[model samples]
Target: MQDFVAGARSAFLRLASHSASDSARSLWADPSGVRGVLRHRLAGPTSAIAFCVLLGAAALGVGNAAVFLGLAGFVAAQVLIARVLQHLGHRLRPDVGFRVVVVTWPIALGALGAAGWTAVNDYHGEVVSLIGLITAGLVALVEPTGFAIVWAVVAAAAVTTGAAVGGSVTGEALVSTGAIAVGAAFGERLRHVIEAFLGNRRELLEETARIPASRDPFQTAERLLQPLVRWTPVKNPSLVWFTPDGRSVFLAVAGNNLPPHLAAGRELPEARNAYMRRQAEQGPWTSGWTVVDGDEGYTRGVASLGIQAGAYVPLVHEGRLLGLLTAGWSAAGGDHSAMAEYIPALVEVAHAAATALGPGLAELEQRSTASQVVDDVLHGQRYWPVYQPIRRLRDSTLVGFEALTRFDAPVTTQRLFIQAGLVGRLRDLEIATMRAAVMEARHLPEDCWLSANASPGLLVDTDLLASILEPIRQPVIIELSEHEVITDYKPIAAALGRLGPRRSLAVDDAGAGFASLRHILEVRPAHVKLDLGLVQGVATDLTRTALVAGFVRFAHDAEFELVAEGIETQEDLDALTRLGVGLGQGYLLGRPERASAAASNENAPRGGRAMGASRVRSRTARTRSQAGAIAASRTTTPAH
Candidate 1:
């Protein structure tokens, strides 16, 4: 099966990183691990010399040629083991070299011990037993869990050879075996503790230091620094964010270890350009912790604190420097030069943090351009309102008109509202638009009602709304769109009550969902408008027909008028009329137009209704070719 091959291929690829043999070797044969343990043992340079002098002067030090020769050979084997561990590459194969050396080491020690005991039988073979005990300790320190496995072969060869040659179950062999068993018992527990600690550390890094999907950049930076300072040698970590102008660096957050002298969350006077120029000239500078050592900026940064050294990791993504993540340490904490092996992991963490803040930083550059355009539009007052006629389905005569905002510029109503909200100017822009619409109400025929869309939040302003509509002779109906929700309308109901006959509320988009249904019941608006999503295909789509039928029944029971919005087709209009809807508005009834053009439509002849509907149908048929691309591109509205 194709699935089986794909799985096998994936497993083959993973073998490079997760081989059992390599896992064992990395634990036992790591060059640095070997060096650190050997440095404290008799095999090391200083200690080896001391050990040789002491062995020569011991009570059983009477020189035997075979044992002396064997000691030279044994020392040679130890040197070879260290050298091979230090220089092992892929071809030198850690598993192969480790197997050969561990086996050869115990054999050489066993042979030397047996030969020396045969020659003298003095000193009770204590020196050989002591070597076995210490060798077991060295294994426990470096390999931990693997000590028991390796010592099995060692005990068999050493004890069997010593007994077969001359000694008869000497007390020395028992001491050596007991020492090894004790170290191995404790070594396994120590290894498990270390493994548990490492697993937790890795999980924390993955959770806190990965590139977030989207978030507040400073919050992400603060999360990243917590564990960096906790687990790593990072003593005092500070994450900085740049101003839009990039002239200053503001510390967003810092770890608890931050020095008392430098209070965080303030802008630093140091010019970022200078540090950047130095990095450009020097190229890819990392002091293992990702900073250039001895740079002038670094020295100045740590001057007041007790920190003697530091790192300045530039958080960059997609060629933009979001900020800098800096960490430092006092002299007593130790140098960062020993962190060379961990540099790759540190760089990975930096990249992830940088990516989290990158998109938010990109938005900053665009804000200036966008804000400027929005300001020009606001100050220029380039937006105006157009009127669309709403007719009674029974008489085919105009009853009201809705005021829709129109812009001379290229922008969608949805995008306009969204951009205004993002810029924190929606309320102001909406107020300005509403004022323009209210001013046009006086021009409407005295017999007709003026309906204008507004958000639910604006319902709280009874006095302001009444004053804005005071100039109009026509009754004003305020309709809140379906896009917004009203949790409780008690305050809104009270506000409208104060205005009395001057204003009445309408719930826009009744049949869409729960928000509109709740608005219908709570506000008890003068009329409820069915959304185009439910009305557009009611003639053909059974689901929409069922939904509109239910809404009609509810409106009839509540004794409130129902207006169907977006009646684009004759089929749609006929469906609403048959369903007992009293009102309808859309392209089919009349296209939105200025007040002068709107006057001719208000009290039209009964014949004009059929003619206007026919013309709308013809225009729709004609423009389907030109507008098809746009209509197709918009995401499905509803009934998805």
Candidate 2:
């Protein structure tokens, strides 16, 4: 019950903020709306004053009996005092002019005693009347809805006392005054109750009316932006996409049509800040693309005087240039600097458009470019994988050949296909490379293995990883580049999860950039490659020597097998051997070549490992011509 009352009161308060006095349909009309209003307006002071006047008349009309006269006068005087106080306070009575009236029987009776009435006869009756009024007032105040009830009790006591002793003018007035006061209090309470109910009903209607406008964005935007557009003048605007070479490629105009310069083949100023920012940043760049009207002199044939003035923000995603956002002054009277004001809003729209497009935009672009290349140059002119042997360092015998991918006709460059954010797509290209290498290796010694560098994104796709690995029967190690940012490792772990336990995971660079030794621990790779920078001068530099030694210790504890890469000379091999590195790969061993021809020199002696090497070796074995293979083969080892 209390919760219900509190909820009702809260609803009332919420409605009251707009207008508390207005009339409407009753939400809470328990006492009945009309009755509630009447109770509120005339109930309190009216009832109290009327009761006092009636009681006074009754006291006078009676035969001047001392007891009746005294009791009636006392009651009248108390009511009079209460009425006067209520008027002075000027507060809204819930029912009557005065919401509450306190009739103190003890005080009234004591006054009667001073006026010559005594407990010896009328004194006991006077005492009872005084107690009754006191109890009645307290009860009515607590449960205000029962004010009329308690007032009746007080009135009944007065009339009964008057009738019991003797009929007189004083007795009649007491009865009349008591009845009037009870009615007035109930009336005032009723009026307030009606008013509260009506106020709540009106508010509920207003909120329900606004429900539809919030859901429609176009409607919402119109309603929200109308004030800004009217006060300023610019409304919905155009956005443009840029090519990799910073040319305007596409345009999406939301409201107004685009200027001629924004169309394709339009030249943009290289002196602008937007051009400069993109030029300076090799990855992604952004700045405000600004333009003014002809007042700033024939506005690049794109703007007439006071016609177009807006800002465009460059949008580059995943290191590939995406586009620009354009918004302008809705008003015609703005200066060229108005372009500056539109920058923030333009940037916001740029971000929204970029996020909506998703990550495939860059990959789609690169695929388009790759398709263009293939269509123009044919498949034979494209990239091909060259196999380099990873032989046993101790025996100078071949263990496996690491497949290295390189482009043939691009001629100017021969690197991995990851620059256009297409590393994931390269997994398909990697699988193609592996298929060719394995099919070629079928003619070689039966025990020979193959190690190939695969794109890291492939590790997250289990099915893709399976397809890539399924064709190769020999032991295959997929080397991941350390240069790429690996935001998530779980996918890599999951991909490797489906592979054979003998399959190896190798991190190409052991200690460099953000790819610290921690990556080794995180991925728990089977093998780690010492970067060429670290391996180049390990024999000469003590610092490099110490660094490698420390890494070797960590590898041993973690159970990771280490490979010192880029060993160009016997001295490099000798240094790695002393440092307890078992395997080495570099120019001094054998340059990357075609798989079949590269394997023909399997038994030949070399400065490093011989082709087709397979004997396993401990960290202590370094020089070629030992019994075991140079590449360590372990079921599983600790992460680097």
Candidate 3:
């Protein structure tokens, strides 16, 4: 029962909202609707004038002064009501204006009925009552069918009562009541016809305003403009698609008769005249179209191109100015008078063009935004580096720090890189970030080393890599992700080879995919870092423990150091140490921090042995043995 009550309540609220919306639309939204007909046809100053003439005829023919005064009072009251409605039309909000119209409508009808009641006994007075009934039906045209019927019935009752009080026959009262009922029914039918016509027009406009499927802006412009040139008196039509900034045109396409300067692929600085430029920027929905004569000073430039008249239409969608559509006529084509007749049709075509070009314009805007973001990061130097400490798992001593990029903008590091790649500035962004990391590495402790990330493509550019890495005085490892697909590793290997003995290569995210094994065999990196997924649950998961053991065996045989990433728990760290993993990094060891904080040893493990003692005993002995084995293996094997 509670669920049923809740459902009924929701249904009722929806119905109420829908009815209110319908009422607002029918009363004031469309210019050709019932509200417009009431203001212009039935309740304007012309209606006031007609009432005044009727007042004069009543005063001249009637001998009863009281009846004449009552009739005159009705006319004055109706004129005042019409004036008030017209005066407040622009001042009130739509809903408020609708309420005012509804409240005043019945009052005006009541006044007319009173005048009809005042003179129902006389022969000339019958004409007055009949006219009042017709006016009451005309007023009903603006009301809902139910309200119109109720108000008409009340007015008919007043007329009938007055006829009986004046000693008129019963048949006469029935005739007066029947007249009002018939008028109300006729008025309701007329209102529905007008509303139907407006609804059809609105639907037609919506159908024509649909987005085109083409992604190319030029093709979209050409397809939309062809209909305008074919159907109307416009002999020459041109479309100027604007750039995202709205400061310049990226593409301009014109009909055959237009000058060569306005041809396809040409950029236009602005529209022909200041008015056209202003109207285009503000959009057609706000400023409408601007028609210019050939002889005008502002149009002299186009006149020289044999164009006699022109109309500028702005292509706007959802308040964004996408482009401008201009239609022109030559002397042989037509004059301003001939073109004026077809201006409405030209506007319809321009509206259709705006809708069809929405997708292409949106894409251009997004690309422009991405380009700007990349430029700010590269040229403005808005990026910096943070360091996450790497530790020796057995002793918990800080071994090295991996430098990662951070930005001033409120965007993810990966997203910035992706945006840069889209704008063809990926290399520039990578190089800039690497250079910043290398510069900040000067602040690190003398005993600690640094590892920085680089793509295979960036490593292939040996000269660019050398310029960034050569300045660092400490040992540096260029870490490459296993996710990148490298068809040729010779260029990258040669680039690292030229960086001298201080620089070494590290294969990052090992054991994450099959490609990491291929990268290990091909590049023969000095260090292979286990992927986080393998290390996260290595404490209990036998499958993850087995994978770590395999990497540990391979690292020993290949003469490479093994590091486990993302050791978040103490159990995982102990598990990795038991598996013979020598180096690791994660939140359990130290989070990434700036150079000053990271280099101060504040982020080091709380009760671990210092690097000085550990380096002398275990790490140095292992490094010396690995270096010796690496040298011997390289001499026997071919270069990768």
TM-score of each: 0.62, 0.42, 0.53
Candidate 3 scores a C-alpha RMSD against the true structure in Å of 14.4
Model 2, 180-242: lDDT tens digits are 554444443544553664444344333323323332222332232222233223544444445
- Model 1: lowest-lDDT 10 consecutive positions: 631-640
TM-score, prediction 2: 0.42
Q: Could you tally the backbone clashes for each prediction?
A: 0, 66, 0
Each prediction's Cα lDDT score?
0.58, 0.49, 0.61
Q: Estimate the lDDT of model 3.
A: 0.61
**lDDT tens digits, residues 1-640, model 1?**
1222222222222222334564345423432232222222213531352245236535466455545544565456456544554344234443443333334433434444444445433433545454444444444444445655465446544543443334544533543343334333333443454455456557646865654635455566667777676666655666666556544444444544443333444555454445643453332223322324444444444544455545566677887666666666553333443232233334556677777777765665456445655566579886777788899876778988888766543344565566676777777777777788778656778888988877766767777777766777888888877778577788888988987776898888877778887787788888999987898889899988888888889988998899998776677778888888899987677667677678766876321245555645644742552363244232111100
Off by over 4 Å in 1: 1-77, 86-89, 92-232, 237-254, 257-286, 289-337, 340-384, 394-396, 406-412, 415-426, 439-447, 467-474, 539-559, 578-580, 594-640
After best superposition, candidate 1 residue 422: deviation in angstroms? Answer: 6.8
**What is candidate 2's CA lDDT for residue 125?**
42
Count: clashes, candidate 3: 0
For model 2, the stretches where C-alpha displacement exceeds 4 angstroms are 1-250, 254-381, 409-416, 422-424, 484-497, 513-516, 608-640
lDDT-wise, the better of 1 and 3 is 3
